[model samples]
Target: MLSTESGEVNCITMFKSCLRYPFHLKVLWLVILLGCDSNLPHTNEEDQKGQTALVPQHKFAGTKTCVSCHTKEYQDWQGSHHDKAMQVADSRTILADFDSAKFLSNGVLSIFYQKDNKYFVQTTGRDGQPHEYQIIYTFGIHPLQQYIVAFPKGAYQCLQTAWDTEKKKWFDLQPDLDIAPNEWLHWTGNAMKWNTACADCHSTDLRKNFDVGSETYHTTFEEINVGCESCHGPADKHVTFYETNAKGTPPPLYMHNNMRPKELVQKCARCHSRRAQTTSFFDYKGHFLDHYDPSLIITPTYEPDGQILDEDYVYGSFVQSKMYQNGITCRDCHNVHSLKLKKTGNALCLNCHEPGYNTPSHHFHKINTEASQCINCHMTGKLYMGNDFRRDHSFRVPRPDQSVEYGTPNACNGCHKDKTPNWAADVIVSHFGETREDHFSDHLLAGYHENLERLHELISNKTYPEIARATAMYYYASRISPAEVKKIEKFLNDPDVLVKNETIRAFSQLGLGNYLPQIKPLLEDPVRLIRLSALEYVNKYEPNTQRTSIYQAAEQEYMTFMDMSADHTSGQQRKAQYLEAKGDVTGAIRAYRKAIEIDNHYNQARMNLALLLYKEGNTSEAEALYLKVIEQEPHVSYPHYMLGLLYHETGKNEKAIEYLRQACSRTPAILRAHYNYALILQQNKQYDKSIKAINEALLTFVDNEELLYIRLVAELNSKQLQEAYNTCLLLVELAPANPNYQQTLQEIKRNLESN
Candidate 1:
């Protein structure tokens, strides 16, 4: 049995091992090379089993040893946020005034206090109850410090509130926002809830032993912080070989000698990526799918340019950059442990780029000024999470010409919000004297902008790079003309899979056409995503022959992919959505169930499966699945709304009202839940309550024709005929083409005249 201190020491040793090993060997298997030595006892059997003994205890060398050789690096890392990322909140670390301060956000209340110089926060919980908890840990030191609250189930969630280290106060993240009272899962929940999702990458050694039966987590680990070993592999063997060998002799360990720039990138990508984990980590070097899952869906996580959005860090953004393609590693600019830039601000870029690259003459501006900074002109800043300022990492050139061509924001125009892109373009032209034309202007700007006709001609010529053409196809698809549609239809047979995929996506947006037959062949495309895209396209417009063909192909492909060693759960979910849209609810349900089997935490598939079950009158099963979904992700509102509807359908009005209120209180999808609640109130003859619910629904959907009609009826029933008449007239004006709106307006007018 391992004592707590022994466990901590062993974990530290493992972390050291991580730093010593090469990045590639760590990602792949290192035991295969090192554990196969014939001189070691039981080496043959161990080699066959692919197992290695625990590294010798004497070989362990802590960060202190590293400081001797790299003094400057050690000093920079000592006071860094990474060093104090996870620590016990005390007089020194706890920035919040915990002596006597209370905060109330929505209906949830939290009280902060200190006992024995240790900080703690007490808050009202999900059960509408108050609980006091000692703050056992803190995550992240700079920017904010998140506290971990203890719960009976060992559950924790990162509180939306954070300690403002500079201001010395606890601030609510959503103070002015009107979130519902029941939405406890909003960032205010205990930090433990997000641990399984994020803590692994941020911390050193994280274990998630979540038990579904009792809904409890017994997660434990050696370190509460991210260390060098998190990115690098174990270093114990390397240390051993170095110390045991003579001073002049070469070490016998395989270091990261061949880790080129690209290989180094993949290592950084493991955490800095905008991907989903395919599996959980049972041990180091576990299979990706077996332990962690990654999200591949087109959600808010990705930008329009296919860069990583604001969800995680800027890893995806860097990958799409010219710097990365030209060979730039994370360590080239940023220190490993301290995680700060090697040089400050714009000076960092000057290390590689010449001073004249953005000199006064080159930038058409005076040098040694605020505006002269390359980042200011190229990477525009945006406000995120209300107060946080972040710069775009796309590293795009100042394309003022394209800005005027399209409506895309340029760095120059971004700084001078009052000035037009054309104004910026004119300034550039004046300064540079139009010596050179824009290199990518034709395809990037003029082709997609002022010269659509000429762009169409160029696209049809097919002399450009397939990627460039594919990019043009995306822009053209957005504002598709009849001629452009025809031109794109011909490219369904393009050899480039990207072009073919874009063509199919574009063609699907145009109304059903003769091109449906031509696009049918892509349903059996070699690429799984392309096939999925084909299925999506057919389901949208031409759902007759094309839909059936694509559906069959998708099913076959799904089975083929599943039967193989690789898991494509997201692809399966896409097929299920297609089946659902095609009215094959049963088939869709099976596909969704299979997707859930592949990844139990896939909330989208699980929710869809539950909704399909509800539609098929499988209320009991649907209810079970919905509860499970809520248990996993209480933040999601659809499950609660559907559960409320299920209760209403089964004649449990009281339960329906409770769930409906919860659903409405939690998310922006409150209109549907409020409307349903109004209907239930009307059925119960609660006129005043029904009117109130309808009014709330109306407020949420001020311009919605259906909602206006519903509000008018509710007002009329409540003896407010004049108000109903006015609302009816507004609805008719807003939705003149809506038959329901016209009928309601006429009926209300007749009733008013009769009265």
Candidate 2:
């Protein structure tokens, strides 16, 4: 009785569920029906509608083609870091002094010297013996150039030894790092693996075809370095069309080049932002883990409260700024090719802002003075990684009053550390009087530090700008009481997606179960991130059963959305997360790999995949991945911790102790590393050193019950009975309600009585 199209649809549906055909065959069948046949009748009204596919008329112009016209831009880019982000190692590219310098770290000895002006390195092999290798590639050109030391798995970490171009001498990066004697200095150590980590982002068309069974990588790249094609799409068609056809005849083919400012920012943001990697490069849209997900990685890259504690360059902070909403692009204030500010100091601000606000009269400072500089006041500078000076890109106005009230630093206090905030505030008042007492200036000085009641007053005051109110709302959201949820909920419908998203984050933090019902509707919101936030809040607050129907529907919708658009970078990352959550490891790994294919800098995805590999007992593959992570981020601590664990599992206690100690020294997640180190020390029968590590663990984590028990055991094993008994008494008193604490206390008491 059904129509012809309905009959075919029914047959396909039956085939999909038949379990006879493979999944690929079923997918191919669906594609054939949906894409090829336009005459099919629609059973559902939605299926009847025709969707427009984006087809660009113009093609991409390769960098070489552009070079003919833009000689200046081309010349400026030739030797820059962006141009040489990846390069095959050679006499010209290799920078390390490989012939003269011999050094030892921990116990691993390495010798670097030059012969025939070619760099060469000799170091301990992975098998705890001496080995020599010629440098085949050099990755990165900046503060340092990392040399590729080839090994069985892949080209391992670039030696910590870098050629200081300006200084003209070899500099040891891990000067204080205690590497074990038997450990390989570069290849098998905690640092210097590039295939799984740095290659995806630093190179163009990088393919890390890791053989899971062999634990080796056939890493290859179409381009040795990031090029014009890295951001702009491949220009093969554009080149052909331009070379063959006249300008009037037909335009060249190209990827979407007419992106709005937001879209353009997202392209730069893909690498510049602090996000976790969701996939591998060979799998999907060319995304790499840790290099792609800005939100997940940025939080940890910075201090707990979101200050730039490390060297995370300003992408995340800029997104949170009002400037981002004002249609600002990275190119607006920076030279993309050179990767430098458009203009140095105050001149950059004068390009957009009128000189009126920045003049000495406006700033209440003497003209032509250092204090008169715009960055000196608005963007405070901080020192990181020993001597690297970086400016805070948050672009917050100086709030001397807030500095005094909440003990937070202000630009005024930053330059003049000896002066109190009160002094700075009094100076401003004395010079400018009430002229600068406007609401924005006032709030900047005190609103963020104000009580919830005061923030509420500001939010309801209508006289204040929405931007200021929204900023205050974000600050107050952390301390917002349950009663205030309704008031904040009103902003959820605000025209600004940023405001609405912030509201959702605030409500999520308040832990209100009732908000789940209200938030559930947002799962169908137009924005993908909003829907993600909604799902996250629902999962956090509402019970699984209560939110089951909504969760499943939302998840299915998100998955369908990902399937429909393979080019959306964030969508692919989310799909991987969803698959992983569903306990589909194989599917999740595939999705993660696909994300990396979309964007190669996704480091978080790489880390997750590595963890999964480690869990699956693929130790060699896991070790390679961990080394890659360390190469990308030398200062990061997770890779070292993972490597320590791997070494410990393989009975390399000395190597484990070395890496775990490095991890504990650098990262805030020190407890686990310390615990493992203590165990390693105990196994070596170094009782004093074991007690020392346990004591350090206790200093930071006194309330950790498991650590306390471990310490008690360490003390007993070391024959420190009196100290163990005393420690047991403290543990019992601290955790009187815990049965294990009581039992340990009784045992210690019996031991004391016997003694």
Among the numbered candidates, top lDDT falls to 2
Cα lDDT tens digits, model 2, 1-755, are: 10112112121112111111011100000000000111122111111011121213223244677686468878877887778886666777776565567776666667876767566788766566777776667766666665666666554455555666555665566566554433323344422456543565676545454554454555655566666656655555556656776566343222244656766676666556544333333211221211242342112244322345455556655654556767777788877777778798788998989989777668877877888988888767676422336776656666676556556567787778898899988887776663554444244324444345566665555554444455556655644445657778787776655456667777765655577667788876755456656776665455353545546755554444454333333445556655654567788788777655544444555566666676667778878877876785666666676678778777777888898777776643444566667766766778688778778777655555556666676787777888887877778876788786677667767877997
lDDT of 1: 0.56
TM-score result, candidate 1: 0.55
Q: Which tens-of-lDDT digit does each residue in 1-755 have in candidate 1?
A: 10112112121112211111111100110000000111111111111011122222222234555565568867877768667766555677666678768887767678888877677777765555776777766766666566765545665555656676656677776577644324422443321244444555655445444553464665554445554444444445555555676466443211144567865665566665554442333233312222222222122443333323444345545544667767777788888667787887668888999878767767766777778888887666665433456666656677676667565567788678899899988887787665545233344455443345545654565544444456566555544434446666677888765567667766654433557577666666655446656656555455555336446756454433332212234545666766776788887887888667655566667766766676687878978987897786676555677677777777777887877777776643444566666666656667677677667666545565445655666676777778877887887797678776677667767877997
Each candidate's TM vs. the true structure?
Answer: 0.55, 0.55
What lDDT does candidate 2 reach at residue 439? 43
Q: Supply every candidate's count of residue pairs whose N, Cα or C atoms clash at under 3 angstroms.
A: 33, 59
Cα lDDT, all candidates: 0.56, 0.57
